[model samples]
Target: MLIAMAGLPGTGKTAIAEAIGARLLRPVVSVDPIESAILRAGIDADQPTGLAAYLVAETLAEIVLGAGHGAIVDAVNAVDPAREQWVSLAARSGQTLKFIEVICSDVAVHRNRLEARQRNLPRLSEPTWHAVEQSLDEYAAWSGPSGAVERLTLDSVEPLDVLVERAVEFLGRPTSS
Candidate 1:
């Protein structure tokens, strides 16, 4: 399964993705760290490093899937284009793609989490609460049940272990032969 983790910043997307990756023993391809490296490599922040990072992650994921291992993508798939890219990748790779959209439904909690968070990506500036608020306006609705695979929506307010368990259920835990 190729799990696409989607949500705005501070929405617990990465945390869940990392946990899922650890539980499933799959590679988690995260966009922020990739974009950070691009910036550190002197790519101007003015450039579309975010998009470039997504492309890079897609390629890395293709390799992971090709290696016969599941891959998890950690990204803020806020818009149709970004989300479509993952759909296309899954189709081309013939992998069953799933989306785990994490949301912090409480405005106050979301804002507080955003303000206190520090990802420590040196070349990548953390998003401001204002930016996340803007994203709330722009984050497009999920396209569907993912067309090829089901999409699971989780509220970040739940405990991390609970969220991971739900995600694992959605992914269908492996059974020993």
Candidate 2:
């Protein structure tokens, strides 16, 4: 199985992904670290690294699935193209694909979380609340592949453990739920 998490930054998508990965014992592939590595390796700051990062994550997921293991991807898949790429990857790899969109519907709380976050990855600044708002403004409506994709939209206003429990239930993993 390939579990793909989507939503803007500070929505708790990464935390959810990590929790799910730990619960399911699947490798979690995050695009942020890949993008940060690219920037650290002297990629021009102005260069578009999102696509490259996604590609790297896609390859990592493929490798994991090929090894007869499931993988989870943590990324801000706010657009159709990004979602489509994952659907394609799942189809080619013959794996069950699930998309879990993590969101904080409360605007004020979302902004506070975004502003208060510290950058854990070296040389990679966290996106500002304004940037997150812009992303929400541009976010595309997602519809999974007909009859083949499973999708879930989670409101991340709850506690982390509760959110992870919900994800485990959604994934039908017996370990946590």
Candidate 3:
């Protein structure tokens, strides 16, 4: 299975993806880490570096799928292009695609989380609340019908384990012990 998680920063996308990846025993490909590596290489992540990071992530996902193992992608795939790329990749690889979107309905909690969170990745700066708010505003609402590529929208207020279990079940797969 190829699980792709998408949402704005501070929405618990990483947490959900990591938990699900652990449960599924799958490799997690987070865009933040790739972007950080690109920046550490002295590339500006605001431009070409960002594009390169996505390409690198896509390549890695392909390799992971080719290895006959499930993979989870953690990204703020706010637009159709980003989401479509993963969908297309999974389609060609004959891997089941699962699209999960994490959301925090409580604005105050989301803001707090965004402001307090830190990125441990090298040379990667955390986004400000303003930036996160901007992303939330700009996020394109997903309208695709759910089927093989299941869409799970989770509230961050819920327990992490519950969210993970729900994701596993939605994918029609058993939860990891």
Candidate of highest TM-score: 1
lDDT of 3 by residue, 1-177 (tens): 888898888989999888888877888998889999889888865677666777788899999999899889898888777888888888889987878988899999999998888778888888888898777677876755323356778898888889888888887764232
Pairs clashing in candidate 3?
none
Q: Candidate 2's residue-wise lDDT over 1-177, tens digit each?
A: 888999999998988899889888988999999999988898977888778889999999999989999999999988888888888898899877888989998988888988888757766778888788777788987665622467778998888898888888888842221
Order of candidate numbers by TM-score, starting with the best: 1, 2, 3
Number of backbone-clashing residue pairs for each candidate, in the order shown: 0, 0, 0
Q: What TM-score does model 1 achieve against the real structure?
A: 0.93
Most accurate candidate by lDDT: 1
Task: For model 3, give the 10-residue run with minimal summed lDDT.
Answer: 141-150
Candidate 1, residue 33: the lDDT equals 96
- Candidate no. 2 TM-score: 0.92
Better of 1 and 3 by TM-score: 1
**Over the stretch 1-177, how does candidate 1's per-residue lDDT look in tens digits?**
789989999988999999999998998999999999999999899999999999999999999998888999999988888888888888889887888889999888888988898888879999999888877899887655343346789999999999999999988955222
Q: Estimate each model's TM-score.
A: 0.93, 0.92, 0.90
| Position 85, candidate 3: lDDT | 82
Candidate 2 lDDT for residue 104? 96
